[model samples]
Target: MLSEQPYPVGTRVVVQGKRGPEVAKVRGEATVPEPQARYGAVLRAATPEDLTRWEDLHRQGEDLKWLLRARARERQLPVKLVAVEFTLDESLVTVSYSAEDRIELSSLIGELRKHTRARVNFAAIGPREQAQMIGTLGACGRENCSSTHLQDFAPVSIRMARDQQLPLNPEKLSGPCGRLLCCLQFEHTQYVDLLKDLPRKNAKVCHEGSGACGKVTKLHPLSGTVDVHTDQGMLLGIPASELKRLPDAPAPKPKRDQPEA
Candidate 1:
C-alpha cells in the first residue's frame, strides 16, 4: 500500500504562492496522498535548508492568520485560518482555512494575490485538520497521534469501545478533534489473541450450584473463571472449559487495541 512506503530524505522544494514562494522541510516521505487536495506531490525527505525555509513560511502563515481573522470579522463570517502552505516549486501558495459553511472566498483570494504577488489558493479543512495544525497532547500522555508517528488514520467505530468495555461518553472516548480516540487501534491485537482460547459469551456452561446448565455471562481469562447465569437467574463460576461453544452465540468482537499494526 502507498501508506506503507518508506520516504526518502533530503529533498527540498519551494511551494509557490500568489504572494511569494515559501519553503518547507519534508518531515518524512509521503506514503499516501494527503487527504486534502492542496498538496501537489508526495513528500520526499527534508533538508536543513528546507527546515529554515519552513520556519519563515510558518511566520508568514501566522501573519496571514491574523489578516484572515480580521477579514473574517469585517465580512461578518465565522471563519478561521488554519495554515499557509507553499508549493514545492514556489509558484503557488495555498491557504487552508475552516468555516461552518462555504463563503465567497474569491474576493479574499484575489486580495491576497494582489498583496503578495503570488497565485493564491484556498482550501477548506475540518476540525481534525485544525487539530493537526495546532497539535496537542493525547490520552497516551504524549504528542497527539496525528502530529506524531501516525502516518495514516484507520477507521474507528463504537464497536471498538464496546469490545474494550470502555465508557460510551463522547468526551471520554473522543480526541481533541472530537473524533474517536486513535489509541483504540493500539491494543486491538491483544484482545484478539486472548479471545481465541475462550468460549463465546452466550454459551451454556455446567453450573455447580443447581447441577443445571447456565448461560455464560463473562469470561475472566486471568483467573480462568467463567461466570454463568443459570435459567433461574443465579450466577455461577466455573472453569472456562466446562462451557461449550454455542452455535447461536454472537461472534466475539474484534480486538480494538494493539500497540502496532
Candidate 2:
C-alpha cells in the first residue's frame, strides 16, 4: 500500500484495508524509480494495535490449519499438508500439500468453503519443494542450500559425482530430493580444471628424485597427492607437483604362428 509520506526501508505497513489488512515489510520506495508513480498503496504504518491483531490472526490461522487438516481427515483427502500461510488481511489462507499421485481436491475445497466461509488456496508441491518451504538440513549436516539461499536448482546427474571422483553409492550421493546432491556441482568446474594438469590414472609417471617410473593409481586433487604403483612394487603417495608424466609404453605385438603348433 502506498504511503503519503515515504516510510523508508524497514517500515512495516498493513495492506488490503480492513477486510484484507495485509502486513508487509518495506524494502524501499514502493513504486518503480520513475517520474510517474505507479505502485500499490499502504493503508498506514503497522501500529502496535495492528501488530497485536497480526499476532492474534497468526494464532487463529494456526488453529484453522489444524481444523482444516481435521476436516481433510474426515473427508479422507489423500494430500498431506506440508505448510499453511495466512494472508495478513485474513481474506485467504494458502495450504501447501504433497502427494505421490494426483490428488482430486475439488470435493475437499467445496467442503472447506462450506465449513470456513473464507478463501482457501491449495498448492501442490513436490517433496523437495516441501522440504525447502519448511527448511531442513542435508546429509552434509548443514542447512539445505535450496532453503537458505539457492535461488534455483540445476539439473544434477551421476556424471557430476564421477567428475569429482566420488563413489557412485546412492545413499551418499542422494539429497533431500532423493536425487543427487546439488552441491556436487558447486566445485565441479574447479576439479575439472585441476584434472587437466594431473596425469591420467594408471599411466606411467616419473618420480623426480628416485629416477623410477611408476603407474599412477589414484589422484587426490585437494592435497595434490597421487598414489603411484612403483617399478619396485611399492605403492606410494607422491606430490603431483614433484612428478613428471611419462609417455605411455608401446603396446606389445600379438604372438604369431600359434595356430601351427
Candidate 3:
C-alpha cells in the first residue's frame, strides 16, 4: 500500500498493483508517522525516466486544471476545479473539484478524455478537502493542520469552543476550512475530563478549610478553582482540592396515609 511503500518519506514513487501504475508523492514521516494501508504500494522510487514523464504530465495537468474550469464555465456548469493528477503511466487523470450540488460532468469527462488521451476520473470535495489541496496559513500563521500534520479530517463544531470556554466569535474560531478550528478537538477531551469532578453551576458545596457553603458561579478548569457565590452574597475563589461535596437534602418522610373520613 502507499503507506507501506518503503521508499523515502518525500520520494516521488510509481505505485503498482492497480489497474494502472499511479504516481504518488511520499507524504513522509511528518504527516503520516505510521504507514497506513492505502490504495497502492511503492512499486519503485521515481527514476530519471519516471521523473521526465511526470514533468511532462505535470505541465499538462496544470493546463487540465484550468481547462476543466474553463470548460465548466463555458457550459455553465456550477463547479470549480481544485486539482488534477496524472498517473505515472497516464492511465488515469484524477480531477478534483468543488460544487454546491452534483453537477453532471459526463460530457466534461468525454471532452477531457479526448483532450488528454487518458482515462479521466472526477472527484468532488468539500471545503475541508479544498483547504487540504489549496493550503493556507492558519490564524496562528502556521500551515493549516489539515494540510500539514492532520491527515484525516475530524468533525469540528462550536460545542468544542464552548467546552474550552473560548470566545464565540466566527473569525477567531474558524480555520481555513471555514469551520471550527481543528485544535479545539485536540484539547477538548482534557477540558471535559477536568470538569468531571468539579462542581456544577449553582451547585451547593462547602470549602473544607473555611467551612463556607455557597453555590458555584464560575469555573476555572486550568487553575482547578471555581468562584463560589456564598450565601453571604459574596464571591469566593475556592480550590477544587479543598472543596467537599455536600449530599443532597433527604426527601421529607412521606406523609402517613390517612383513612378517609
Candidate 4:
C-alpha cells in the first residue's frame, strides 16, 4: 500500500483488507512494481481508535481460539488448533488448524457457529503452515524464514539438497516443520550453474599439471576446485580449469557365443 507521505518501516497504517479496513505494519518499501489490484492505498496512519480496535479484535480471536480448542477436544478430533483470526470488520472468523488425516469438521464447525455471529471458516493447514503460525525458532537458532518474511511457500525437494552436495541426512536437512528445509531451494540454482562447467564425480579426466589421467573424487563448485585420484596414487586438489574430461574407453565387442558342441 502506498501513501503520498512516506512512512518509515514499522509504521502502522490502515488499509483495506478483505473484510474491511485493517491495521498493518509497514515492513519495507515495495521495490518491484506489482499489479495495482494486488495492493491497496494506505488510508492513513493508525489512530488511537484504530489501535484500540486492533487490540480488542486480537483479544476476541484468542477467546474464540480457546472455544474452538475445547470443542475439538470434546469431540475427540485429531487436530492441533493453530490460530483464530477475526477480520477487522468482525464479519468473519478464520480458524486455522493442522491435522494428519482428513477430519470431519462439520460437528465442530456447527458448535463454533453458535458462539459467533460472524461467518466461521475452518482452514486445514499443512505442517509447514503450522510451524509458521507458531512462530518457532529453527535449528539455526533464528526464527523460521516462513514466519519472518516468506510470503509464499515455494516447492522444495530433496534434489535441491543433492544439487548443493549437502549430506543426505534427513535430520540435518529438515527445518522446524520436519520437512526438507525451505532454504535448500535458495542456493540450488547458483550451485547448478556452477556445476555446469565441472566434471561429475568418478568421471575420467586428465590433469594438465602432472600429465596423468585421474578419476574425479570430489567437486568443489564454490571454490572451482576438483579433487582427483591420479593413477600415480596421489590425491591432488587441482583447479577445475586445469583438468580436461577424457572420453570413456570404447567397450570391447562381446565374444560370439560358441555353438553348442
Please tell me which predicted candidate would have the highest lDDT against the true structure.
4
Over 1-261, each residue of candidate 4 has an lDDT whose tens digit, in order, gives 456678889989887654457788887775424454344457799988888988898898888789878988888989988898876677888889888899877777776677778888888889889888788888889999887656568899998887788899999999988998988887889999999989999999997877888899888989998899999899999888989899988977766795543
Instruction: Give the poorly placed runs of model 1, Cα more than 4 Å off.
Output: 1-48, 189-197, 207-213, 219-226, 230-239, 246-261
- Residue 131 lDDT in candidate 1: 74
- TM-score, every prediction: 0.67, 0.64, 0.78, 0.86
Winner on lDDT (1 vs 4)? 4
Candidate 1 has a TM-score of 0.67
Report residue 54 deviation for candidate 1 (angstroms).
Answer: 2.2
The per-model lDDT (C-alpha) reads 0.66, 0.74, 0.79, 0.82
Task: Report clashes for each candidate as comma-separated counts.
Answer: 28, 5, 1, 0
Clashing pairs in 3: 2-40
> After superposition on all CA atoms, how large is the RMSD of candidate 1?
10.4
Worst 10 residues of 3 by lDDT: 30-39
Task: In angstroms, give how far residue 46 of model 1 lies from its true place.
Answer: 4.9
| lDDT (tens digit, per residue) of candidate 1 on 1-261 | 122344445445443322444443346655445664333343334567777767776677678767877887888777777777665444567788888887777757755765466577888877666777689987778878777545456788887766554668998899998899888877766756666667767776564444667787776655566788888877878776555544566766667685433
Candidate 1 total steric clashes: 28
On a 0 to 100 scale, what is the lDDT of residue 261 in model 3? 42
Worst 10 residues of 1 by lDDT: 1-10
| Residue 76 Cα positional deviation in candidate 4, in Å, after optimal superposition | 1.5
lDDT, candidate 1, at 31: 40
